[model samples]
Target: MSLTIHWTDHLTGIMRRAADPPRLLVACDFDGTLAPIVPTPAEAALLPGMEEVLRSLSTAPGVHLAFVSGRPLEDLKKRVPIAAAGFIGSHGLEMQGHVLDGVPGAAAAWRGRSPFIADAIRRRTEQLPGVFVEEKPLSVAVHYRHACSADAAAVQALLQDTVNGAREFRLQEGHMVTELLPAIGCDKGTALCALADRLGVPRSAVICCGDDLTDETMFTGLPNALSIHIGPGPTAAACRADSPADLLQLLQHVDAARRKNLRKGSCGS
Candidate 1:
């Protein structure tokens, strides 16, 4: 079945149904959300106990948890050994158990074609100096913060030119980095929607949290769910959580709330 969400207004009705609080399908993005934004993408790691908290939530009754990330599935597994919980990797390009409607079934096939691009970008930038490329399994990120202002500009121009003719991929700009990834229909938003559908939960029962441009994609078509913006953003449903630790604290609160509600339901029953 194909499912797509397009608004938070649908949440009001679900919130009403959830006055008794419905079962929740909670999802979050890694990197800027579950881990801090480090200087290099490779250096980005989850805060201590972050994975444990996710595991706890995944096991908690009334709560369903998933790690939705831009990083590849293998990389996420290596970094966050979440067992039995849902994993949505590669900016929703890939998922465990199910594939999203708009995403190509053979999408990962393109993963290998990008290293050549990464090497070329790296070789060119190495000469101009300071700029560097951090290659991931499914994508490559060009970072310029360590480069001199002039060198960074030169590298950016080269990147823009390199990506101009490629229809198979495009660039994703984030804090001091530009990532080259396959151009496709998958994104965090679609991934979350797909997960919620697979879990058989109403959109209102979903809560999504994140802290970057890639995360903003989850907000695009979210209906019947809390679209939480972690740091200050131009949206109304925003909540400010200063760091990854803060995000973990917030998840703890949600877990507690779900457990309490479940216990109450059990007692009343």
Candidate 2:
């Protein structure tokens, strides 16, 4: 069976024609890519077959899988319910297994942060008409999705200023929301690099797929790997698929290619 190769048109066919399917390292972004995007982040769930596919890919020969997300690791574990794969949470600030550190028991660490921040954000945003704030372990997201365009900018400005008092953290800009996180030097890219180094694999063997601006950092860590951008983003990685279904199809193609390479290697041996 043929595999889609639009990505190869721009870059080398390194991942497409591997002799032994070079130790497969697959990293993916969570929202909008693995899980269908929802109105509220809490409402998002994995696409129909994502768990099965992820499980299979993780157990597949020579393959390693990790979920790189801005969500907290504990939240990711609860939401996804997969235990074997590595997880990079809070944009890689709190990681587990091979990809992250500094958060052995993130629940405890998160609790140490000021409760006042959450309370303050909630109370202040409630009075702003259409703004809302969702507190996270490593960050707090001030969502302006429901606000009118006229009010959005004003609410955003107010929230930004409020978070500015959090001198230890920096603001992360996203769609309809702005998040505040620690000023740590880690991101999804850093997470991928840490994993690759721990696994002792060259960057060319990795395959990272994502759908947001934060994901671009992951691609930077894997300069030689196959990078697939699933949806619209400001980064240079072209859109490889339009939806989660398309992403599944693409994974099936890559798996088929790897299986074919394995068969050929066995026969040649």
Candidate 3:
């Protein structure tokens, strides 16, 4: 059974944890978490004032911010221009402008396979109306958001058939999008774990917020971390924020609490 808790009920506890560690990792998902999901991915932007909030949090002492997304790294960089924060892109297959650690030769191998799979997908779906193939560095997303019911079904069937016997790639389904990524041992959860490790912080010191099925990995993988799921549905997150607006409110509260604690520490010193 899943229980939904409000951010207010847990704010005090979170603040206490934030003060204890004197360090925190604020990791967030990009689409549907920080920005409202739009029909076109290229046009997505941070919710009003969210960029400013994130910038402030990034600069806060002992607070590190990160954007974890399924987007390609370059695309994510274009959308979120925060130089202080780290980025884990391509569903954790890519990290900090390089293929995630532990996958030494996997990056080169995936690069060779990516174009072949992308081309095969495009060839199979090019004639299907309303189907858009988005090519990433190590993956390809087949977007059916604009397709009618029949076309959408056709797109799905085509994708399933194209990768039926393929061993080099795997499929991931999201809201109106299907992604083909390299068959690897990485995901958002692993990415979060890796991030915490790299920062020399415990999972207890990390806070991760996301709004999709892909985000579930981070929530479950970092059981010790403070996990928040944006918008309702069954989730492993400790709390739920009703919408992006609620998420913003939660961030504002965290920022205020941290700053207050910092000032208090300075006074005592």
Which candidate wins on TM-score?
3
Per-residue lDDT tens digits of candidate 1, residues 64-117? Answer: 677888777778767777665677887888777433333455566776776887
In model 1, residue pairs whose N, Cα or C atoms come closer than 3 Å (at least 3 residues apart or on different chains), thus clashing, are 7-223, 18-21, 203-224, 204-224
lDDT digits (tens) for residues 61-156 of candidate 3 = 678888999998778888998988788888887778322333325754776666777787788888888888988888889999998888889888
Better of 1 and 3 by lDDT: 3
Score residue 97 of candidate 2 by CA lDDT: 64
Which regions of candidate 2 are displaced past 4 Å? 1-21, 98-111, 163-166, 265-269
RMSD of each: 5.8, 4.5, 2.7
Off by over 4 Å in 1: 1-21, 97-103, 233-237, 266-269
Off by over 4 Å in 3: 97-104, 266-269
Q: Of 1 and 2, which scores higher on lDDT?
A: 2
For candidate 3, the per-residue lDDT at 137 reads 80
The residue-level lDDT of candidate 1 at 193 comes to 88
Greater TM-score among 2 and 3 belongs to 3
Best by lDDT: 3
Give the TM-score of each candidate: 0.82, 0.85, 0.91
